[model samples]
Target: MNKHQTIEILLGLLGTLLIVFALGLYILNEPSRLEQAQGDILQAQLNDAMTLYAESCAVCHGLNGEGIGATPPLDSGALRTMPFDDLYKTIARGRFDTAMPAWSKDDGGPLSDYQIEELVALIQSGDWNETGDRVVNLGLAPLIPFTTDPDPVLVEAVGSLPDGATLQTAIGIYAAQCVACHGTDGLGTGIAPALNDPAVREKPADELTRTITYGNAGTLMAGWSNVLSPDDISAMVALIQRWDEVPTGVIPAPDVSIPTTAESIALGAELYSANCARCHGPEGQGRPIAPPINVKSFLSSTTDQALQQIITLGVPGTAMPAWGDRMTDAEIQAIVGFIRQWEATAPEVAQPLGQASGGGGPPWLRNAANATATANAATQPTATPTSASPSVAPSVAPSVAPSVAPYQPGAEAGTGQGGGPPWAQEQAQTSGSAPLDWRVLALAAAGLSVAFTLIASGISSLKKYR
Candidate 1:
């Protein structure tokens, strides 16, 4: 063969080998590649679902699906083993008369069908460890639970009952686990049915046991089989049955009164205004950024210790910050004291200015208002326009510049102050979704490189033939 023909033959052979190699590689890796792609899609779905769960569900269900208060755990084995369709329906339509609201858009919820599916998949197969890690990375860790001892007066009251020992044990169990939804003495709250009612007392012993063990389906009442021993549940059931024998005054009001002098309250007032008023409202009325602390229900239900602890540790996954690191214990106590003073006169229900959740408020406004207020308070007389005063304005201007620039009507989007407009800000905040896997990108780059090599060889061969 001629040298050109030989060259052409060599190029053809090389191209053939390359093609064969690629085909063989693909054939060999097809199953794994498909699995990886599916996995990537699942991961993306999980990330999206995690965001939704964090925003809407985590406040009650917990950041790690660990369950908070009376809410049941989502990461439990029972949910994992639940049929996909059943779980999907539960999320879509919600459990009847429960806190688990219908999430699908069809049922007047915010989620679409696809979103609901993603959440179902996440619950069934997603890694809770990964979910927890992501939440922590995003600084949305679950709140530090209230760990204070039970109210001494309540403890003493229970201790003096007819069956003091059993009552004490049951009271301990109830206070530790059950009191969140079932109010003290099993009177029931907005969330759960009253155990002290005649209906519960009239139920068969076996039925009561089964209900406590297995929990009422499609309700917020979670089974105690996993959390409490059979004995503990029996004690709880016994406590419920004996409610008729127990007098009304047996369970006295919890004494959470902190010794707050007028001066301390005044200091707390100043501190609350300076730190908490922007979101919680100036008079403890609910604002869009926070729930009302001044509401009668809140003040009555929440003890002074709880209020202090909540302030100190802050609620996780919410905008409420942990003042433990920022303020002294005394300061937090003072703030709680200030909040406690509103109990007697607080309205039965709050007229919240916006949603009863925090973190949805315009952060820029809060920051700007605080900045402006501080600046105004600290404003000294301008030094008569001296050259030094020109520098002073420049120095002070930068401090306020970032806060002021974003609010201007004509400011460029995402250019000056607070990252962008409020909508843009939300978009920016939520832009950290899972990205394409590196392996996929690598494969694409490799394919391009191979194609480029083939094209170059083909062009050279054509030139040689000409």
Candidate 2:
């Protein structure tokens, strides 16, 4: 046969095989199709049920299931976890104490057994469970304007721990909730850091417990406070501390052997901007995660030794990370000394920090958004990690206090004042970069190359024949 004829034959065979395989695949997926149809019917029923819930229940229970003030929320873990039968009983026989009325037809209410079943199905649908918040957010905020919620309550971590009296029982909680991210050995996993690391062990028990409870914000970890009881969290901390080799707990102040000379102070300022500025505020002026080191109250209260310990151990449960593992004793001391210089700058700092819009603060202390903006906008005094000049002071400014109106969520966004959170200003910097995704272009090129090769081969064969 000629090359073209052979090619046609092969194409015919390929088509035949594809048809057969397609039929087989369709037959194989019969059960799945049936299940999908069933799910669709159930979903339609859920939609109808939702309508009923919104009309009847949402008033007192909230627009969603989030209960209004005084009224209990319906989107509760208990409701999601409870057995259908138990839930049905509760719906039919409304709570005697609470405002929740009986909706069951048997109790002379409006809803029939089927409707109650539908509502039960909706609740059991897991709308408020571990991964349901995303869908919930869609229902709550479809437009999501920037000004709507500038300062959202950022959840630090997620997942729950089972209640247990002893530390041994607490391991089960870690196995179920945390083992995926942290790993069974706690040496760290791909997603999370090792729990047994010196940084984790040396943290104060209260701090560790708080971390477990709140979870870390700006990460996938959800605060387990909703799921785990205070006792459960404490138990986890105890279990974690036991893993430490040096017997976990307060790390003593390391030697402040680093001289506090001009050269050292300059180096310390540079280091603080690079390492400490992110969480501890732009320059040790504390933020939501860390308190201000430059503030009069902070400097006056904490000793140099205590500052060294804080820098090494890091305050528990907050964002302040331990420098002990990364930084030397001298480096930490230098940062401490840089912070001490601010003692003189406190009044200057506080005067600016006082509320801008007459917002009440620590009474004597002041805070204004304009001050925050000025510190942020000033190009010269800004914290420079890359270019540290001995002459230039670290321009790290205190994070706006939550109490200050300028720092409030409703404050003017992107105005250099309390515009949104600190991240808002950074948006301008991040809005540029790789305009094209090389991965996608590479894939397209690969597909085209294959097609070109096939077409060229066919033409080459035809030419040879000619």
Candidate 3:
């Protein structure tokens, strides 16, 4: 036989052996490779879903799903126990008479069914149960949260309030200044814990004042000592002290005479406005620091005696303050009278967190808004935003189709169309879903080239023999 023929046969045999070995190795590792691919796809889908949530849902539902201004909490115990399908439908169709718009492409908001599923995965994820408690401010919305410091810079920037600030004046301070996170009455909302907590009042006056001045380090709590005058800070501290006097969550009865005259009621109004309005809105619209006294159920459920006690004693663990000496019995009654007057036009506030069970607000509202705004998403189903600046509206009505291009070959591999990103486009050329593995073809081509060269050399040598 010619030398070229023998060499050719040897090359062919070597190629066959390599092919067999390669196939064997592939077969052994295929399952793990497929599992890895599946995991990657799931991860990618999750990333996309999270991005969508942040951009679309976070604005209202809260960055962490804890409710914000009138928004309900998503992590509430009631919602945690809710069925998956019901939750899906709510997210897709959206509730009427409320701010929640439909999210499904079918309904009109923006998310695809697959994306919604990922959102569900996010809601049901282990980390989602971060709410359900009013005081524990984990996963607060806006992440960093609003900080108020007494820094010279911050104080200079915001400027100072007038001197001789009264508790009523501080009420505005707590309301306009503090309620964004603390809640109206200081029960603690989704963002910050109750400054009304006895622990705060129990702390040394200097320590508390210093903490408020510098703001808490490594925490969302900012200090206001610099921005506020010593008198202003004193007024706030005094207001907080009133809450400490309350025996517990409920106020204890005392021997003070209840006032009812128009003059007394007027005085109470001013007092509530100056001292309480900051935590409870001037209009009595409860804040992160307190519960809404304007709520219909709150009025009906609570008694005059209880309200009076609250005015006199304040709720120890909460934001309510004791009036024991700061004001006369008539004055405490005046504050109660002011709250009573507000009840007449309180605007049917949503039940405070945890109390919606009988109040008819969504069960979620019972927790701070449903840990405030995002949680009640299931709860209040009734609250809405305060004429907020229009956000980048979510996907839009699902029924309307968004324009998109048709699929093409190597789209996933990123080669066919505009070739995907650099990596993806290259994948199609090599280890991709191209039907035939490119590596094998490459090996074959290399082998053929070498074989041909050898054959040509052999032929020339044979010509000499001839």
Candidate 4:
């Protein structure tokens, strides 16, 4: 009894020890799985934050966070390496002297602290190699305002400008220098504020001129004082002042001429069809993917100077590719000229008209005209009835009577009023007689004669007629 009891007790104790060991192993592995789940959740949140940052911040920070002009770069930047708390504060507060716009509520940007935290985490976690080089923290001083009064010599030079300089002339100057960042229409791009908006328009004339001449502090807007004389600055100011007054309508001075020689427009047509039809459409009516090159819209929306700039420097961070490298300046100008010519000749919305007979027919018409002609032919009366058999004709002749004559070559074809070749006369005699409109029949005969004459003339010119 003692041995049996002892054996049973020992087995129970061994089973309990094994169960405890298994529980201990499970406990040891649980934390790792939990940590892995947390890491996955964090990564997902980071991805979402990165997407928002790209849409909102990447424009200024650059696609890979390689900042341009005034906006500081973010890839492994000092700001990124800073303590999380300090980084959070700076993002919330925003730097004052630059275009590094505050993105948090306390600093006037729209992001919440939680969102900002997520963004910061994502930026910090990004590999510098994959993203870009680390931004240097030079701790450069903020741009200070001018302390000295305007130079008397400069003031006098600006004051000497004639009061009658036109805005168009001023825009030409701006296009050469300022349009890259400020945009062709004065609507700001990536790191720049819009000059066409009310905020810029409301600024005093002198302030505007000073900003243009001296440039804004801590921004990419470089001082143009070196490039442009004070007088030129004054002209620019006058132009900006008149920006509101400029008429929003088409000006007709630059009349583009289409070459009368078919070769030139024909080459242009082929080029336009191949390269531009995808976005601008076969007729230059813009699709949703691209802006309209329609004449009225083009004239109203872009100045001549602006068009030149856009062709020269493509917009950044957009699908608009630069053609300057591929196209010669003369080629660009020619293309512009062609576009202008198209606008002039295009039918107005109020007065719709088809392309002129010589101007190459409307694209849709050219594409479908042959198919439409074929369809019409199916219903038209042919020389012989398709269903009639020569053997059975006599049996059915009385019921489906058709007047026919023996075939003869040029033997006074029926109603021989229309001038046609000998082959047409033979055809008329063999086929059933049907009434044909004299005018239509005559037109067809004349057209065929002209075509054959041209063919014969071509052969003669080629010395193959003998």
Q: Write one digit per residue (lDDT tens) for candidate 3, span 1-466.
A: 7876677667756666666766665676678778767755655555445555544554356545776656687656777677889888988766764545567766545578987877776666525322211011111223222222222332232223333235455554665456545543444432355666656657787877876665554333545643577777777776676643322212111222232544445556667767875665445545566655566655554555356545544544555665532544334445676677756654454435433223333443335442432332333322221111011011111101111111122222211244333323433354445433655675576567567656765776688699
Best by TM-score: 1
Runs in model 4 deviating more than 4 A are 1-18, 127-183, 187-466
Segments of candidate 2 deviating more than 4 angstroms: 1-23, 126-466
Lowest lDDT sum, 10 consecutive residues, model 1, at 398-407
Give the range of the ten consecutive residues with the poorest summed lDDT in model 4.
136-145
lDDT of candidates 1 onward, in order: 0.60, 0.49, 0.49, 0.46
TM-score of 3: 0.29
What residue pairs clash in candidate 1, if any at all? 289-358
Task: State the weakest 10-residue window (summed lDDT) of model 3.
Answer: 388-397
Number of the top-ranking candidate, with lDDT as the measure: 1
In Å, residue 190's CA in model 3 sits off its true spot by 18
Model 2 error, position 16 (Å): 10
Q: What is the lDDT of residue 139 in candidate 4?
A: 7
Assess every candidate by TM-score: 0.37, 0.25, 0.29, 0.35
Query: In order, what is each prediction's RMSD in angstroms?
Result: 18.2, 23.2, 24.3, 35.9
Error of 2 at 420 (Å): 38
lDDT of 2: 0.49
Writing each residue's lDDT as its tens digit, candidate 1 over 330-362 gives: 455567778988887887655333233353447
